[model samples]
Target: MQFDAILKQKDEIIQQLQSQINPLKNLVEQLLAEVKLLREQNAALLELIKEKDKRIQKLELVEHQYHQLTKLVYGRSSEKTSTALPGQLSLGIDAELVEACNINDGQKIESYTKIKSEKKKHPGRNEIPAHLERKYIDIHPENLPADARTLRYNRNRTIGI
Candidate 1:
């Protein structure tokens, strides 16, 4: 009879332990699912970041090309030539010229030049109108003789409104 009671007690303890372990197992499964979802999100976000980086690089290249095209269209057109003149040192072109002449059996070289034209004048400011009325006032020296007054006469002209 004592052994039967002990067996009954052992079974009750096992049932209690199983009941506690059930909730813990469920919690562990939930945590594992959360961790898996987080890992998937991290991977997706990393791929998006990589795609954005590629797009930014492409946009930067396009913007650089656009700026280059704009500068070619609107920038200064005149450029100094690097062509070797009469007294300048002939770099590598002389060898190429000699080779070409030998291959072509002494072909004569001809030079061409553009014709010069006169540049148009750019007037800076508007000219004053000649039809405007002018008023002149003359001042004589205050303490001068008649002959000295003529020498000290001052004249000023003001355009009438």
Candidate 2:
């Protein structure tokens, strides 16, 4: 009878140990899966950061070019003036703006010639309507000198143009 009782107690202890160990084994597997998921998420985040860094570098280069062009055009350092032509507009002015009475005089001359030619072709059409005819006035700027005008242009974010 004594030997039977010892055998029964040993069986019970073995059964209890297996019950506890089964749950612990399942818990460890779940923890490993969670760790793998976190690692994948971290890799995705790193790729996104690299893309943003490239875009930022490109913008900084364009801005630096714009600053250099401005210095060439205005004959001054960047810190000197708050008023400046837009980045792309400076390119237009560099191509078009001449020394004669600032930049727009040549443009105005061309427009005037076109209007006069049109008026000569159509006599009755050339008559100014009452609503269209108005006194012309020029508003002077307070900050810039008499000859200076501000032209602004927004930079295109697209690469190469």
TM-score of each: 0.40, 0.41
Error of 1 at 57 (Å): 0.3
**Residues forming the 10-long window of minimal summed lDDT in candidate 1:** 152-161
Report the C-alpha displacement of residue 30, candidate 1, in angstroms.
1.2
Q: What lDDT would candidate 2 get against the real structure?
A: 0.69
**Whole-model lDDT, candidate 1?**
0.73
**Model 1 over residues 16-44: C-alpha lDDT tens digits?**
99999989999999999999999999999
Clashes of 2: 1
Model 2 over residues 66-134: C-alpha lDDT tens digits?
986677777666544544556634434331133224544445434334444344554445557678756
